[model samples]
Structures are given as C-alpha cells and as structure tokens.
Target: MAFTGRDKTWLRGPRAVGLLAAGAAVVLGLATGGTVTQAAPAKPKPTHTQIQLLSINDFHGNLAPNPATSSSGNVNGTPAGGAEYLATQLEMLRASAKAQGQETATVAAGDLIGASPLLSAAFHDEPTIEAMNEMGLDATSVGNHEFDEGWHELLRMQKGGCLNDGDGQNNQNSCPDPKNEFKGADFEYLSANVFYENTKKTLFRPYTVKKFKDGQKVAFIGMTLENTPNIVTKSGIAGLTFTDEVATANALVPELRKQGIESIVVLLHEGGFPSDPKAYNSCPGISGPVTEIAKNLDPAIDAVLTGHTHAAYNCSINDPANKPRLVTSASSFGKIVTEVRLSIDNATHDVDRLNTLANNKIVTQDVPKDPALTKLITKYQTLVAPIESKVIGHITTPTVVRTNDDSLESPLGNLIADAQLADTSAVTNGKTPVVAFMNPGGIRGDLASNGGAVTFGQAFTVQPFNNYLVSMDMTGTQIKALLEQQFSGLNGPEAPKFKVLQVAGITYTWNPAAAAGSKVVPGSIKIAGQPLVDSTTYRIVTNNFLSDGGDGFPAFTTATDKFFGGLDIDGFANYLTAHDPYTPVATDRISIGS
Candidate 1:
C-alpha cells in the first residue's frame, strides 16, 4: 500500500525503466516476457545459455478486474488485472522464450492467496491454486499471508481436498465442489526461514534447482521475512521458529554451490517501496527490507525476486562488492509480471551477472483471455454470485487502506476500528470497551463507493482475514503500553516504517524524533475526550490480529477478562449497515509532532 505523500521526495532517486503501455481503447489491457525494451542481442553460443524468469507476487487471488485502477497502475487510464489476463501474459512470455531457444520458468514471491477478494476466499482459495497450476508456476516462497489460516492449512492448499466441516471449522467449508474433490497445487512451495523449533529443521525445502534439458541448472533459494511471527496470527506460527532471512539464504549458498549449481536466484517474499508509483519497472531509490538483504547476499547469488510489501520495482542494486545485480518485483494482483533475462556463461556455468535485465510489464486486458482460466473463474464466480452481489451498505466517500506516511492511520483503518467499538457497544454486555484499535495491514483494500453503494464482495475484499473481534480489560497504563508498542520491536527506527494504527475512542500524538518505545508523546493520549488514567482499568477492543500481538503489539496479550466477539468482517459489515450513508471519520485521531 502507498504511504504518505512525503515518500515521493526521497523516492525519486532511483532511475530504472518505468515505461507503461496503455491498454487498447475498448479492451483496457497488456502482457509479456518478450522485451518491448531492447538491447544488442548476444552472439549465438555453443550451449543453450539464456534463461527467462517470469514472476508475480501478492496476487491475493484476484481473478477479476478490481473496480479501482489506482492500485492497478498508471497505464494512461485503462483497467488491468484478472487471472485470465495474467495467464495470457505468462503464456505469451513463455512462448516468446521458447521461440528464442531460451528455457522459461514461471514463479511467484508469495501471497499468491490470503487477504483475497470474495470469490477466491469464498472457495478457500482453491480457484487460485487451480489458476496457478494452469499458469505453469514452477515454485514460490511462503509469504506471511500464506499462513493466514495456519501452516497446516497452507499445506492443505498445496495438497488439496474438500473440507468436511462447516464455518469456524475449516475456512468456511470452502473446498471441493458438487462434482469433484479439490486437487492440490502442482507447483512447489518453499520456505527456508520458517522452521519447527523442536526438530531444528526447516518447515519446507529451503531451495529447489530447476534442471534444464540442456544439462544446465539454476537454483532457486526461497524464504519469507524473518519477522513472520510478528505479523501473522499466533496460531499460524504456533510452534514454528523464524530465522534471520539473510543468514538463511547465506547458509544455503555453500550447499547450493556444492551441488554444482552456479546460477543462483533468491526468490524472497520480502520487498521495499519505491518513491514513484508510476515507476513500476525501475528500481530507482528503492528502499525497504530487500535492499539491505540484496546488497549483503553472497555474490554467487545472481538475482533477488521479492514480494510481501506489495510494491513494484525492477531495481539493479549493488551487491557487497558494490557490483550491480538484479532485483525485481511485479506490482500485486497480476497488474504486472517481472521478466528477467539471464545469460549463463559457457564453461564457468555461472550467470553473466552484468548482462541480466529485468522489467515490470503491465498485464493489460486487450488480449484474448486464457480460455481455461476464464472457465475456472466463471465457475467460482457463478457459485458465489449471491454473496458477491448482495449490498452491504452505502459509503459517502471511498474508504482507503493506505496509511499516512506521518501518522500511519488510514480511512479504512478508522472505519474498521470504529466499527469494532460500535459492534461491541451495541450488545449491552456490561463490559463495554472504551477504545478500539485496528492494524493498518488488516485493512486490505479501499471500499469503493461505486454508485454510492457498497457490495458484500467489496466489504469482504477490505477485511478478508475473517478475524474475530476481541474485547479485553487492561489498566490505562497498559493501554499506553499498547500504543507505544506500535513503534518499536518489529517496526523500529531502522526497520520498515512503523505500522500506523487506526483508532476509535482515543487520540494521541507521537514524535518521530523520539526514541523507539518512547515515540508516543506523553500526556497526549486520551480516551473519550478525557485524560487517560494510568492505574484505572478500562476495557479495550481490537481484532484478533492485535489481541494475539500480531504486528508487534504484545501489550494486547496482557489484557484481563478477555471476550471474543463475532467475525471481524461481520462487525465491519454491521457497522456499515447501522451507519448508512456513512461518512468516514476524519483522521485527526493520530497526530505527529516535530
């Protein structure tokens, strides 16, 4: 998600290619691995050397075009996204590589599902797994979102079958169909960072080498961020241990080299944001977790394909020796596909690092939709029409999930937080919550005020985690500690910028210049327009995400007299229904000081 406006200032430093091809006037779409941007072709080699790596990340099971195109990309005012268009783009690129005698490998950087739109989530993301199989995905890293339903369920995604239970039992009983049982994913899922503490071994294969028909091989090392536990559900990572990302990849370098795999590519599920939103293809001044990881990686590793931040960049940042190496990411939801051309050396078996080039090409909808993917999406869409089309409520203005760069709060965050507080207050359970907080990451998409009315599908897309509302009692001081937790630990000064929270029944100002844990300004926190009393007990409410200390807020776990409410989505939808023609609350709740 895009942060504050100030980010654009420093973000302008990176100058990589960011060209976009506008879609056809009536159709609105584009695709490819075939370079529209060209360089002098290499002379014919005695061996088949060039390899085409095409990838996408954070797809979130988007099988149809999103209503708003802002997240899609600035393609001269045209629509983008859909499994059909993404498949067509992949096929076109694969075909182009085949014609040129270069082997093509399609892969992803994680978040292929989870936090998905209604249609895919309605079916436990089975449609997405099927779409990936049809698109020929070879391998992928497990992003934090992959564990939304816990690791076992993630494995279930790969080893598909139908759910025998009902709601609250197995992802809404979303599996199989009237005619067939769900088949597992055909591609491979790898994770080097996530491990089972008891066995002291990785949960999934750390790396997989794709051997070509020409006897040449390229190793794909995969892993999500080291901070997976901080951001995912507690049960999702119950017994698993997350390791340092750089160390994990570095440790595998020697092992991969021993296998005679000279062409090493790291497929990571961690990324950084770029300064320019339109600079989709280039990695100029790209900043985030991936930058440090890429520069520190052993030079033996040639390229880094990253995701999870949901930002797009085709950056050629430098390695430890300061040698320029490729780093690429496609914009999420299949808006673009990153294509990297790598030329392997003849005798050394190593990739010609200097010759590698990457681009983030938009998946425009002008081409013929891949027939099979279209059929797959159509079947699910047909099955989900009733839920997808039902009206949830009306929005006076579009509700956004993007956080403020300075304050961190977002329109959608505010809406969700207020909804939670209201959802509990109406029940008249003597233990009413005085305040509510919502994590910015949980607010997935903007609830577009299309024709001034919102649909169930639109609301579902915004809050798809299916998290339940949790009310807990804590002292006023404990509440302060909870707010303070938002700044440090995972989102420290040096880490990715802090995850600004959306709040209700509370207001506070923080100073960015202050030390990490002390960032929340003193005497600035208030609840219900009254000074916060440190010693007095006050009931607080938040989604299950925060109650479990997900995203670094551990104080929530310390609350006493805890109670669980209905599904968070239901609370949000109910809030919308109760507050018809709702105008979102202003974002003055969280302020910043110099």
Candidate 2:
C-alpha cells in the first residue's frame, strides 16, 4: 500500500535531498451484526508527507555488466550491472520524485572494492570510486574489503589522496596527478564503530547529518562488521580496531538525538539472505545475518540498509513490540537497486511509518548503455585484457575442489596442496614443510584443462577469492586433533556439514564402514613415508580461510606461530607462471583405503 503521510517530518534544506514517506495505515469501519455484507466506503487519503530513499550495496567493483544467462524460454537478459545504467536509474528515480514534490537521496552500504575483477583491483579500487562518483553515490559505510588495501588506501580512495594532480572529473584542483587529469569521488565514507587505539575516535565521522529542504534532519550512521580485522588482511587494518555494531549504534543514538536528529538510518556493510540461483530479482531460499541485527536494534533508529551477502530481500521483520520494522537488501554485483520510502512524524521527528517498494529490475538491453561510462570501462578493459589473455597452463580434465565434494581428494585440491607444500618447504630455514593442507572451499571453480589452455583469467576463475597464504606451527598431536575436528559433525537432523581437506606430504585412509569417531583406518596415516609422530610438530602452509575456521574447519583456528604471506592466488599464479606450460601431475593427495 502507498504511504499516506499523517504526522511526517519535513526538513528544510537547499534542495530536497532524500524525502522518504511511511507506509499506509489500515482503515477500519463499523458494521452491524448478522453477517452484514455491505461494501465499506473507501477511507480518505492520508495527507502525510512522503520521501524516497534510494540505496545500493555490495557493488563490489562491478563497474561493467556481468555475463548473464537464461534458458527454458526465459526472457532476454543483458549483462546486468554498469555505472552508466545505475546512474540512469538513479536519475530517473530522482526525476519521478521531483515531479511528486518529494526528495531523494542515494547511499550505499559498502564493500565498494576488494576481491574485484582485475579491472578494478589492478588500479587499487580507483576505478570503482570514479564510477561511484559518476553514478552520484552520496555516501557509504566502510566494508571489510575497504581494508583490502588497508586503512590508508581507503582514506586515499575517499579523499583522492592517491589520484594524480589536476584531475578534472572530481574536485578539479585536488587530483594528485596533474598530467593524467584523473578525478576523484565527492562522497563521504562513514565509520562509526571503527577506531584507532590511542585516540579512540572513529576512523571517520560516526555519522553524517543530511538536511532536507523542509528543515528535517536525517542522520546516516555507518559501520562495518566488527570482526573486520579477522576477515581482512591484518596489515591492512594495522593499529585499527572494530567495535560491536550494536554498541556503536547505541552509543551514537543519544548523540544524534541531542542534535535534534530524530530520523536515523543505518548504512551497514553487512546483509541477510541469498537470491535464487535461477533469478537475481528474488532470493528464493536464504536468510542472512542482517535480520538478527535488525531485530535487536533500538527503536530510535528508523531503518537499516545492509549489504555483503549479495542477496536481495524485501521483507519486514517484527520488532520487540511486535510492530513491523521494514528491512530490505538488494542483491550484489549491481544486479538490482532497493528503493525505500520512509515517513516520519512531524511532531515527534521519528519514523512512524514506512513503505517498502523494492524492484529488483533486471538491467537489460532495453536500458541503453551510457556511452561516456562505457568508454571509460573500455579503456580499463583494454589495460587488463593482456593479463587476462596470457596462457597459464593446461588442465587435461575437470579438477574438482569443493570443500565437501567427497571423502576422496579432488585433483585440483591435490595440485594446490602440492604447491603450498613446495612453497612452504622452499621458505623454511632448514626445516622443510613436511606437510601442507589446502582448504577445499578456497579452490572456487574447476580447472577444465580438457576444454582449452588455461589462461590467467581461467586461473582467477579457479581460485577467485583473494585469500592469502599463511604458515603456522602445529604439533603432531595438534595436527591430529585438527583432523579430528573436521571429522566431528554437528549433532542434529539439520546439523552443519563439514568439508573435507586436501593434504600433501601426508596420506590418510578413512573407512566409511567404521564408526563415526573411528573412521580413520588404523596404521593408514603417514607423513613423508614415516608413521605419524604424535610428539613431533610440523610446519604447515595453508590459506587464510582455513586459518580463520571458514568452511566449518575449526582445527585451523588452533594453528600457532602464524605468518601472513601476501595473496594466496598470487602464490599459485607465481608458481604456475614460473613452471610455464604446466600439466597436471596427479598424486594421491588423499587415499581412502578399506
């Protein structure tokens, strides 16, 4: 139902920035007894003011359209995302609001860069910031990936510290490189909870107050995940700390209230739900972390816009009082945009009503591409084209590496395990890496060597997530305990499942017929042709994912004396490139014996 403003907040500003209205109320009518079947008169229209809040999240450096597919007589779908298309959509939305005398404001939740395709990553996220500026994004919360290049780089992206001087597109005079004439974005990056140790002040302003034409104030409080350091590279977040989201927001609420800002919106770099694999417009079966946060938030906050899960969901969750609090998340990869209309009580200066009008529209051919942005994209694409086209190696057949594929090790997993083992051995001072373990899930896609020669892009596809390599010390018993951790399963009908590990320099056989706790066959475990030595410790090499207990592997969390190498994929790529024109040397990384 369309929102009819009753007691709505109307703020006055130079321009009506973002005007959001509340949802409509249920009209009640009196009726006589005896099953009266008379049609009730329509309720009078509400006179409350309305406004539009336009938001996007988890864009993740998708400055161009992604490859899309449709089958079974599905409608024609174009590559969905592009800065030009997003700009067009925002402009059109703003125009519609202007016609209705409403205000519009655009914001993003975060994860603007990092783990991006080569196009954005190669330039250290400068391209993404440029695209975001062109698309007119006003502000965003810092995502974990924002720390991919570390806090200093994040600051540079925000303030154009790294761009060349005299870049015309941004603040013309402020560009770092005068000759190149590159521009920077004109937006604020907020971080309410992220802070430095000594000063204890937020890295950036905790929130920014956006004043509207009607003299109302809307405060956007932005923050990233509290466990950011755990997810991002440690060096990137040096001397920085992330506090709990709830604690941070709660602390800021009273301060915002003191400033006469009653309407509060949280732009957080986290989300809930997953989109249907068959359709980006809808999340078929997924509920993520955002719901939990929304449910527990203080009522002073009106709404929350979230991202990170890359799922789209438009649904209202109940508050503590059982009243509905509208919550929504649009899918990532620029697949869709979420528009929320909010209504605030004029007298109370609080959000009393809200209308959720989310349209996860497919960016199709019908929406003509913006020529200017397309040209910029082409320039960057050309720059990375050579790297993408370079032949890396060949895969004679499909090599699987999904964590939970099976008890048996996958060929790709074996290859990565060998690489890690060899690299770790080469690095140790005298003591060689006797064994190496690679997390299965870290190996994203398969190597279809039979199809054609593997290129850099193909290698990227094989191991997409930018996980780094780490070496840690573990006693022989600790290693066994780690292996045992993977064997343990959650106890329940719908318990969590575990993914198998791919190990090199070690061989172990497990019998499915054996009891759950005794699955490993006796005398079937060996490392470097020696019986497993419980008293001896070993130096192991693996990815950051395993070190962090991702994929339900808690054993890795116990690894000590950790060393963080650079990017894991870089290590793999360097290994492959050095051994050019490679072929798979299938070794029994794992063996299941009777």
Top of the candidates by lDDT: 1
* Model 2 per-residue lDDT tens digits across residues 1-594: 111122223222111111111111110112221111112232222444455777888777878665465121122344566677776777787788779777776788888787676667656667788788777677778888788767887888876655443332211123222455444557778887787765556677677766665566788778787767655656677788777777677667776787788888888887655444444433344355565666566667767777776665555554444555555565676766776655555566666533323444554444766676787788777766765677766554454343333475776777777777766423545555678887664664665443556676667656656667778888877777666555564311232334567788888877656655566777677888888888888878887767766545566777777776666666676667666555665546455667
What TM-score would you give candidate 1 relative to the actual structure? 0.86
Q: How well does each candidate superpose onto the true structure, as a TM-score?
A: 0.86, 0.79
Which window of ten consecutive residues has the lowest lDDT sum in model 1? 20-29
Clashes of 2: 39
Cα distance off (Å), candidate 2, residue 487 = 6.9
Model 1 spans with C-alpha error above 4 angstroms:
1-48, 73-78, 165-173, 395-411, 425-430, 449-451, 487-489, 492-498, 509-521, 581-594
lDDT of 1 by residue, 425-511 (tens): 333368888798888878777787578788877888788998878888899889888887778877677666677778899999999
The runs of at least 3 residues in candidate 2 whose Cα sits more than 4 Å from the true structure, single-residue gaps closed, are 1-46, 70-79, 163-178, 181-184, 274-286, 354-356, 398-404, 408-410, 424-426, 444-451, 464-468, 484-502, 508-525, 544-567, 578-594
RMSD of 2: 8.2
